[model samples]
Target: MEIGSSESQSECNLSIKLGMEFDSDEHAYDYYNEYASAIGFSIRKEYANKNNAQGM
Candidate 1:
């Protein structure tokens, strides 16, 4: 199943790049979730922004 914008499903860009920005975390989630679904898989948040100094 597709999971992106209503404008078009075929336009989804499954590739990721550096310095991408979204309006909100929700928008980022939607973009990634769509990419994951396109590749025949689903995504979940295991952890966010892990850093050695932060101990996350």
Candidate 2:
């Protein structure tokens, strides 16, 4: 979770900073999705494991 001024994550901003602090992208995405997603969301372990393996 390296902080940066990149357009994608915007590490200088609050959420990304907090996300990096949390150290779990899936959790952070879900937390953000609480407001961002109109419908409920799910964290699939298959996706998590694949992404974790790929360092996504």
Candidate 3:
């Protein structure tokens, strides 16, 4: 998956300069959650349907 600044990157004041690869989506989510929590941020899970191109 690609990691880049969101449209409001400036508002967040955080930047990710590295790329990460995971064996599965669950793994990625866990890693992200841990990182966010460690850095005093919160995140939520949103499911995307493969059939829904618009979601992608």
Candidate 4:
């Protein structure tokens, strides 16, 4: 995903809160991945606890 200047800036100011909604898990990953890259970091592995059946 190509982030424009303004969008990239927002990514730079990345924050996490409880109950954040994303289009999909990949979308969430991309969002964080971009933020991490901009801050001179990379994500090698990801582990999240989610209850898909219960939509938690």
| Count: clashes, candidate 4 | 0
At residue 43, candidate 2 shows an lDDT of 40
Q: State model 3's lDDT.
A: 0.62
Give the clashing pairs for model 3: none
In terms of lDDT, which candidate is strongest? 1
lDDT of 4 by residue, 2-56 (tens): 3343454564677545698999988988877877787556785557798999978
lDDT of 2 by residue, 1-56 (tens): 33343354432223423425446877666665542332322343343344656677
| Candidates arranged by lDDT, highest first | 1, 4, 3, 2
Q: Write the per-residue lDDT of candidate 3 for residues 1-56, one digit (tens) a residue.
A: 23433444345443444586779989877877766655556799986567565655
> What CA RMSD would candidate 4 show?
8.5
Quantify all predictions' global Cα lDDT against the true fold: 0.70, 0.44, 0.62, 0.70
- The CA lDDT at 36 in model 2 is 30
List the candidate 4 regions with Cα displacement exceeding 4 Å.
1-18, 46-56
lDDT of 4: 0.70
State the weakest 10-residue window (summed lDDT) of model 1. 1-10
Cα RMSD for candidate 2?
Answer: 10.1
